[model samples]
Target chain A: MSFKVSEDVAVCGGRLLKLSHFSQVIGTIMNVNVYLPKQYYSQTDNKVIPAVYYLSGLTCSPQNASEKAFWPFQADKYGFAVVFPDTSPRGGDVPGDPEGSWDFGVGAGFYVNATQKPYDKHYQMYDYIHKELPTSLDEYFSNGSRLDFVDNVAITGHSMGGFGALAGFLKNYDANRYKSCSAFAPIVNPIKVPWGRKAFGGYLGADEEAWKGYDPSELVKKVSNRGNDRILIHQGTKDPFLESNLKPELLLEASKGTSWEGKIDLKLVDGFDHSYYFVSSFVPEHAAFHAKNLGLI
Target chain B: MSFKVSEDVAVCGGRLLKLSHFSQVIGTIMNVNVYLPKQYYSQTDNKVIPAVYYLSGLTCSPQNASEKAFWPFQADKYGFAVVFPDTSPRGGDVPGDPEGSWDFGVGAGFYVNATQKPYDKHYQMYDYIHKELPTSLDEYFSNGSRLDFVDNVAITGHSMGGFGALAGFLKNYDANRYKSCSAFAPIVNPIKVPWGRKAFGGYLGADEEAWKGYDPSELVKKVSNRGNDRILIHQGTKDPFLESNLKPELLLEASKGTSWEGKIDLKLVDGFDHSYYFVSSFVPEHAAFHAKNLGLI
Candidate 1:
């Protein structure tokens, strides 16, 4: 859990650290981006700050969401922490392809715990993100740095990341696992989509029953707690994939008739599409949402 | 001019155009980033909009000012145009740099009319940005697009680009040239600095008097326009180049002892450094400055 790429981002010399951590479940080292806020050093009484994990969509590495989205500004302002992990495991030791397209292989990690032979060895993104990443971040970044008033944990992501964030939050649901779970252009119900079919089948074998465990729709149906206090989703009306991969409607369906106290706010912003331009447009809102829920701002 | 980079940037479409012109003096082809208000297409034009051109420091193209600092969101609210031009001409068979360091070569096209050999042929950034870019934009972007509200214009830049913005406004001194001028960590008093010495010596030759024409301090000293304009500068106490390259004191000195008509607002943002992070922290303020001048919220 040593830092590799460190850049001086803000005053008080707050540093953004990118580290390579060996995920025990996946058996591969994953690169993660961490924004150590301005108060990290000043209040070094070992207080833990609230953290929001941002998962990237397809064809994106940890760098895409960090550099392109300008996440540090929001992270710095709200005085919370943000963690960016690579979308998927690479190298053929993991399953090579689910139909081998740009949308699936290499870049698309789908945030699932793989069950198939080749993939099961390395494609444990669910555990790597939900469990391993938290453990690593706790030991490495918070060392000697007070993070108090920052522990309103939240999970948020974009597109595939949105799905991943949902899974990460639901499966790890504790009394205070995540205060909020929000997504930008999230593919809410991945179990019924083409992307989900290929990725789930290739990584999790031919079992649709197992897929339900990772599916947001199924998770809400089976689990009653849903410790994430709220879920906010922003969907673009003009998103070409809105009707297909990013079916926000199914999540709406899943939430119905459940005693779960979590609220899902689905906002369809006009003229927005599935691009970084759209993500960046609403990124401030998303950051503020988590910040408010986390009690940072 | 067609839009190349227009998606939803903070509720508006940010447009960038590749402009080509038969400039009698400078290069024939250049690119500029244009941010149009969301209402530009939707609103019926009953009024005009004000715009500001931001110049970047050394070793950057027009895209640097746009990408490094998320200017489109700001431009959207300002309801004005933000044109960022390439610092200098390239791909023309001009003198190649013998030195490889970026400070002297292609990227560092100091916004000055070069008199030195090799550079003299095409190093006409001053004219390109000032005359050519404006002329082309006025012809193509302002008139052809729904940007009729571009009646007011302001200029702002960072580091060397800041010097260029001030020098351009003061040298031209148009009540119409720009309604305001501002900067973040600008290299003020370029004629009296080491960086200015090398760049001016190389481009404008060793004649200090000739170099003075390109210096903002000298230009501000001669300001005759006595009403309704002000200059704003935000300097960082921790900027590494504060002592040598950026002399905000020189600008203050030149503006002293005269009504000068134009006000100077020099601010020292505490603990900020000379990075995109620093600029980004206050980018909204600069954009709003132009917006208020543009008569839009």
Candidate 2:
């Protein structure tokens, strides 16, 4: 479970440490990029730095968000670190989309523990991201360090990863795992979407109940929002996938009359797309939100 | 002289309009990205917005800097439009590096008007960037528009384009074309380096006199610095090509006893490299500097 340092690049007022480590849950090597803010290096006092975990969308690696998201500057501003986890487990031996499509294969793991044949062995990204990777990172960096990668943390993502963030936040809402949650053009209701249907059908083996455990719309009704927590969401109107793949309105509809009613702050931005340009434009706002929740404000 | 609007992406508080037009000088289609600040769309009065032209380094298109430089936010912050010009004229018939190398080929035009065979036909980047592009863009957008792409503008670049900016700024010093000049890890004294030697020899023939016209070190002594103008430059200490290809000290040495002596602010930052990460880190400072020079402050 020891992490291996691959490349350390200096960005903004921080350093982006590209790391790879062995994952016991997936039984494969995983790549992750962590941006340690300037405070971590120029620490004069022992202050625990909170972390914001950013899960990327489909067909994205750690480098995509690390390079384009412009998160390092905000992390430096707020005295927090940003952790970018890879989208999917990748290798030559891994089974990809049968039709050689981009949406269902190597780059698109959908962040789920596959219970099906051929994919069950190595496609355990659900556990890898939520449970194992954070514990391993905490253990690796716990050498008299005060960087909290586990407890005092927040979660955010884009598109499918946005679905992951909402699902993870809702599933662990009872335990109060994540301090905050936000998403940019997220696939909120995945079970009813085409991309989610294929991924769920392939990974979870056609079980509707199994799919509910990973769907944010279903999780909202199961978990109670006691803190009156506000989950921020920004969906671009010009996003090409809004009508077909990401029906965010379903998520708001699902939370109706529940404990989480009126708690989801969904902001429909004007003239923006489903690209990183849209994600990065609102990153400062999300950073401020996360910083406030993480007690750095 | 007409521009074709290919892709208009909304980034930050502005619109990144990707345009392509036939260059009369280079005799080829060239791609350029223009980021019109929010002020342009929300104009309530006759406010003339200035432009900043950013040239890319070797093996770069307009997209590289457009995607990674994080200039849109700064452009919006300072109320300035940013023009990202292509490194060189590119096509299937256009000749590339003889060795099929990256640093001396199509992407590595070095922004010089070549006088050599084959390359001379399409390698008129110096004129295309400094003359044709600005004029065409100005004419194209002159329909009840307040965007100034010609007179009140600044120039900045990275690596080879750094040399281009310094050369262009100094060459047009008497005309007062650009209001400000800056570079990030630029090739200061290309005449004394291998990259410069190869490009000069191939494009300008073996005439050292012709090479001097395009060299920043040589231009500093020839052109007079009027208004106590300062050329801001940031060189990374950890940049792999600092000593060999980019001899920024040589430019300083050549500027000794000249009008530009003690005027070039060459800052050697620690532990940085020749990447967009390095450039984007210092863009805010450069943006503020240009804002002051362009009277935006």
Candidate 3:
């Protein structure tokens, strides 16, 4: 878990840090982009802002959300930390495309702790993100952030990462660990979708019962789903993956049309695609939505 | 040339056209993004506005400039047409990189009309951009555009495209082709620079004489240096390539210290890199710069 403060960019008084981490989880060194909003320092009396961890989709890294998705301005205004970790580790330790066709190899960390042979050595994203990664970030921003705020964390993501956030939270539901949660265009059930099936079959080795542990719909159904009293979900109406991979309705079905369904606020945005343009067009609102619920003001 | 008008995003009443072309010169089918400002309809009854073509650098397509670069507002103010052509052709008959790499194979046209081996069959960028490309664009804009305004074209690009714009204006030297020129962090002298040497040597063979035909420094030495007069070059002082590849001094030297010395208006931006962050920061000014010169305002 050792890292050097190699590069720093002055962004709205806070710093955008790029840290290189060699992990047993992802095997190779991972580059994570952490955004410490200006409020972390301006408060002066040492107040840690509530934090949000944003995970990108397959074929994406921490850099994708920070640079392309326009997350900082919203983070700066709302006063929160945004942690973006790479999808998968790079270099030799992690196995990549023997046949170099985009997706599935380097940038694709399916969020499941890998159980298959070769991948098991490196692919431990579930643990890396949910457990160890946050522990490290807790220290990284502590210099400028207050200890109270770090404890008040919210986890959310897009596509695969969205699915990851749900599974991660449901699996580790010690209400004390995280204060709230949400997702933008999440893959609700991986076992049911093509992308999820392929990734799950390859990584987890075809155990249907075991697969339920990683599926949000299944996880939500079994457990009484509790985090924030309200879970905000934003999905683009025109996303190509909407009808298939991201049937957010599944989460609704799993909530079993009960009180938990009332807890999930689903927003359908118009004329948006699966691309970053779609995410960026609505990132500002999502940040504010989380901030308001967290009472960050 | 039979492009089926796939997607059109209208900004300021001017349609950004995505056209398909079998670029015999570049040896593939190319996608070009053209922006027609509001003035195309507002200015004079049937008044056609002059145009400026913007070429992007490595790993980028025409869409990159138009989408996130924030060029629409500036284009509307200028009342001119801005064209963005794909860096290179893809999935066509063109024999591009049997082994793909980001630099030489695709998305990195270097804007040079290739001459070596497999590249020569389709990599005729010089002809495609300077000749075939504009002919159709002139026809598309129609009316006076097909007549006078379209002919009064200025060329500019960032990085590799900057080098392209310089070479296009120089070698072609069609008084009717490009009326003026400028660049954004362009690779000025390829022969003297590592990137240029690798690309030119591979594409044009070891012919220094032929390379000269493409080098801005060499081209400037032969032609009217101040032709870039009233031209503006916006570069970041912190640009990583400032010393190595984009030696503005080489361009400064090529003009015999006379042409663009100060008149060309070299702006050295502080605390910026060669990345889009730097480009996005100053793209508005560049649009305005060309718009003023093109008389679209």
Candidate 4:
């Protein structure tokens, strides 16, 4: 339940704490990087700093987004801590893609709880990311009562992690798990997309009904909007995976006539691609969106 | 004299143009990345955008700083373009380190023209970076006269590139090549350090006099300061190579009684390492310094 600090780096006006801890849910050590804004260190008025969780895409560790996403600056500006979690569990005994492909094994857990064969033992990333990770972080950093990891928090991600954010947010919509949600070039209709179909088939088995539970397109139709809550999303027009693996329009189409209609603000940015260059470019806007939703404004 | 565009990426209200060109000075193809800020595109006011050449550290290419330095946002903020130059000439028939080390060859050009045998063929980085590259860029982009790659420019770098910026700026001090200069964890006294001695000896062939021509510590005493001009620098206290390789204080010590005394602003930032994390953290400050010097602020 306790995290071991591997490196505490000074970035921006705060510290980026690279932490590793044994996960009871995933049955493996999970790595997460947390950036505590300067407000956390010098809070004479004892203000409770909120947190924003940023999930990464395939073939990325906690280090990629921590280094290139340019979140530390915005984190400092909004007085919020940023959490960056690993894409999947790694190391010994972890079963990788059977075909030895990058999209299926090792780096690509797709943030799903596997119900299939060999994967069932360790690939419980859905539970790990949404449930245990947050609880553990809340317990670890809430000692001083200066950091709020659970209550006053927002969520955002890129690519595959975008789908994870949409799915996770909708699944826990009734409970209000995340105050706000946003994604950069996210895989929205995972059930319809090739990447999501493969991941869902492998992790949740061929049961399409089980896949529906994690599909954002389906979730938008099922989950009722509480108030005037909106989900911000930015998709690149030049993204290569647009038509094939990430059909974001399916979510908008599915949300038609549902409570989420017109509530999913999808902005297609011109000339942007599916890279950290794209993610970091619009991070300022997303940070501002999350900041307002988290009441930091 | 012309550059080939490989990847033109849209990032942070601008485009990052990944370019490769045949260098007349180095006798090989050199890769570079240039970022044109938003002002270049929507220029109804006809502003002449200045350029800032950022040299990378050892074991780095133009891509390292282009991807992680977080310069595009600042460039967009100040309406100045950024040019990221490769550390060394690479590829087909280009010889690397004899010892197969990262610090001596390939990515570690040290930004000096080599007078030695094998290295002399393609290691003319000093002339390439400070001379031919700028002249070629000016010719290529000055068709509209909206981009000032030559007349109004600044230079800044990290580690080895930091040393390069200082050496290049001082050697061309009388010529007034760069309007402003700054560095992040630079190798100021390279002639005295192990990395410097190895690079200088290998490239300049053991001639201490030839090495002094590219040493900032030596050039600081030789080059008279023009007016109240200053060089901004940020060195992380926790940088691993501070003591043995990057002794920044030596430059200040060398400038003690010279015309450049107190003109070198070396800031010692606490708890920061020698990673892009540290560079990106201080880039805004360096950008502002260069902006003021380039008359962008």
Candidate 5:
């Protein structure tokens, strides 16, 4: 579980460490970027920095959010580290969409453990991201206990990765895996969307029942949110895929009459599109939300 | 003199207007991005917002700085609009480097008005940027005098664009064209550097004397700085082009015994490279400097 430091860049008041490590779950080399905020390097304070994992949208490597999400400044402001993991396994022999489409394969891992052929080999991202990657990072950075990866963490993402954050948070809701959760233009109901249907049909096969295990809308009905715990979400009104692929209202509708009712903060911001421009504008608010939940405030 | 709005993107309490217009000086269509800060749209405030022009480095369209510089937040904070102009005239029959190099052609206009063959047809960036572009923008947005693109403005850039900012600011020092001037790892002595020599030779021809007209190092000796004016600069020690092409020390040496002596704030930051990562890291400091000079503090 040793990680190779490919590049350590100084950004804002901290360092963004580009790391690559071998994941036994996926049997491949995965890349991830972690931002160690200014507080982590403070010589006077021996505080353990909590991490906020940020998952990127489709067609994004760890670099997209690291470069444009404007997270480093917020992380420094809130005294928390940020972890940016790749969307999917890349490089040789890793199969992509059979038709050469960009929406699937390669950059579209969908963050699910594949149960189908060809993809089942390396598309074990559900395990790689949630189960193995965090533990591995916790073990690697255990030198001085200056950074915490396992406990006292928050999760957030954009678009496809946003859906992944919601599903993952809901699946591990009872265990309280994440202290806070938020999404930017996320596909809340994956089973009902075209992008989600295609990714799920390919990775989880024809069994729609199996797809429910990873769908946020379905999981919202089964999972109960602890009292006073709220999930914050921001959706752009001008997003092209709002009606067709990202029906965020479905998640709220599914939570009605359940223990999670009225706990989802769905903010429909006007005039914003589904670009990093939209993701970054709302990042400051999300950072503050996560910071408060993580007890940094 | 008319600019067509291509995309109006909502970001950080304002809008990023992607505009294209025909340039009478360059004899071609050009692209520029302008961010109108939140104060511009405020109903209660009638303040005429000042503009800060951010010239981009080599191989960059106006989009590079608009997307990555993290300037919107700072602009909103200081109530200043940001103007991002293209490096050169692009598309159509406009010529690039004869050898197809990225550093000289297309994106590398060096912000000069070419006096040589072929390039003279379209490489009129000096006139376009420092003169025509600003006047045209001022005219285009003169509805209620909400934004002051001219008269009250500052200038700053990175790498080749950094050189452009310094040269432009110095050449027009007597007129006080730009109220404040700053740069991020700019080529200070273009006549003495490889990138500068190649660009000057291609644009201005064999007469080395003509190059001095656009060289900041030479201009610093000729131009007298106003009593209280100072130029801010931040250079990364780890920039790959620091030694070979970006000799920032040359400008300091040239300023010795001149009116500009001890007025150029040259900050050498350690461990930063020549990417947007480096540029964005120091943007807040530069923003504050320009904000103070522009009287927005």
Candidate 6:
């Protein structure tokens, strides 16, 4: 699929390219933002630049993280590109939550391949984000450029997007699709959370086994983590969703006897919330972690 | 007389306290956001933390710069507090532009004390920002603290607010009110520009003499500069308003042959715009400049 350049605004030593492309997987026009670090423009070396895909929380577009997450500075600091993918396929015809609640409808795709009726027509976001989008971007930018959008990439997200990152990373762990993975106040065990249950029930036709494939708590048990691989996670204590929506402790408990035990670096920060303020506050640490894993440091 | 706390958000190594207070100067409850850096909470030393007052441009509230400017990191890095003040007094009863244009109404006070009818009753932003707001904050945080909101302070802003900073800095030059002054895409020669002419005509009632009092280009000639005092400025060459609304060159030209000659550090950044992305891109440099002037360096 071809891409259209909507806006290329200069931000923090580089440019933030806002692009909209026709996604073959989702059968809709998907919006995504890519920040190319200053190194890309000033590069004398012929090295392929790795990418970090950031999935946003509920009620978010690619613009939220692109504007507030402050990732451009971090991307410029260590030579890597950042990709901000939209939460879901949004249009008038696209089926949303019938109740008009923010948690269930559009902007809350939960990053899953839908099997349910009307949603299945345009809600193939899991394939759109993790597979089709990256391949298309690689093809779009492959004009004598060595920007690797497929391999040597890191993944991170906030809340629902955080759940997406973990599930995607673990599902592709054997193939080593993502070199590094991190989350900011993510819903680690989506299978046990209300947000996950509703989304899974709506999109996957209430199939509990289908839900397990996208749940990090369940996926961690099935996917064997190779030796010395760590997944970084930060959870805010003051986050209102900690008790009912995002019980991060469940993921740790599920990983107790597995190879993923002690490999998940879950840091509980004090007095922070589930906002972009929290996501940006710790982006430097996450960037450095990804930089190390991507061989940039 | 008393401040009301609305939302206290944790951001970057600090907390953003969103406050509203009834102001005698403006005759309304004014909104302000103050960012108390991490050092404010974790201080063992009795060091007086300096403050930086950031004035927003037209049609912006306290939230615009607070969210997009990315100043919290630099404030924490250099141990200073940042204050974001609303552009103008806004309410339904308060008078706005009869034409309902965004340029000269509600959000466009131009940081001047209004003398005209229908606006003078509530649009005293000049006194509200520079004098009353600081005094109120100092009184609010005067419990065994060393946060200096009055004396050891820096001033900076973008576009309209940039002009405000320059005008305020120059008007109080003899008193040495601010330790440092900087701007991003400011309208320097307000007397000659259309936006300034309209604002001045509306706020000051057709008095060109009164307009010169707030014009930085005119103030440069009237106010004798002290030795070794420099004003730092960054203007985006690609700013859409550079030709019509913001003629930064006139300020430098007005400073020629005066005591302020060669003291203005005006940098024309390449490919930048009149957006917060441009402001944040250069915040590190401005922060360092202010930090040095505030004696933090």
Clashing pairs in 6: none
RMSD of each: 4.5, 0.9, 6.5, 1.0, 0.9, 1.0
The alpha-carbon deviation from the true structure for residue B193 of candidate 4, after best TM-score superposition, in angstroms, is 0.5
Candidate 2 chain A, run of 10 with poorest lDDT: A38-47
**Candidate 2 docking category?**
high
The TM-score of candidate 6 is: 0.99
lDDT of 1 by residue, B151-219 (tens): 467888888888888888788874466667789888778778887788888888878899988888777
Assess each prediction's global lDDT (C-alpha) against the native.
0.73, 0.91, 0.73, 0.93, 0.93, 0.92
Chain A TM-score values, per prediction: 0.89, 0.98, 0.91, 0.99, 0.99, 0.98
Candidate 4 lDDT, B1-297, residue by residue in tens: 999999999999999999999999998899999999999998484889999999999999899999999999999999999999999999988889999999988999999989898999999999999999999999988777688888899999999999999999999989999999999999998889999999999999977988888899999989999889999999999999999899888999999999999999999999999999999999999999999999987
Model 1 CAPRI quality: acceptable
| Alpha-carbon deviation at B99 in model 6, angstroms | 1.4
lDDT of 6 by residue, A96-209 (tens): 898899998699999999999978999998898889988998999989876889999999999999999999899889998999999998898887878999899999987798
Q: CA shift at A260, candidate 6, in angstroms?
A: 0.6
What TM-score applies to chain A of candidate 2? Answer: 0.98
State every prediction's TM-score relative to the real structure: 0.81, 0.99, 0.69, 0.99, 0.99, 0.99
Predicted chain A of candidate 6: TM-score: 0.98
lDDT of 4 by residue, A64-144 (tens): 999899999999898999999999999999999988888886889998899998999999999998899999999987676
Considering summed lDDT, which 10 consecutive residues are worst modelled in model 1 chain B? B1-10
How much native contact recovery, as a fraction, does model 2 achieve?
0.75
Q: Count the clashes in each prediction.
A: 13, 0, 6, 1, 0, 0
Model 5 chain B: lowest-lDDT 10 consecutive positions: B143-152
On DockQ, the stronger of 1 and 2 is: 2
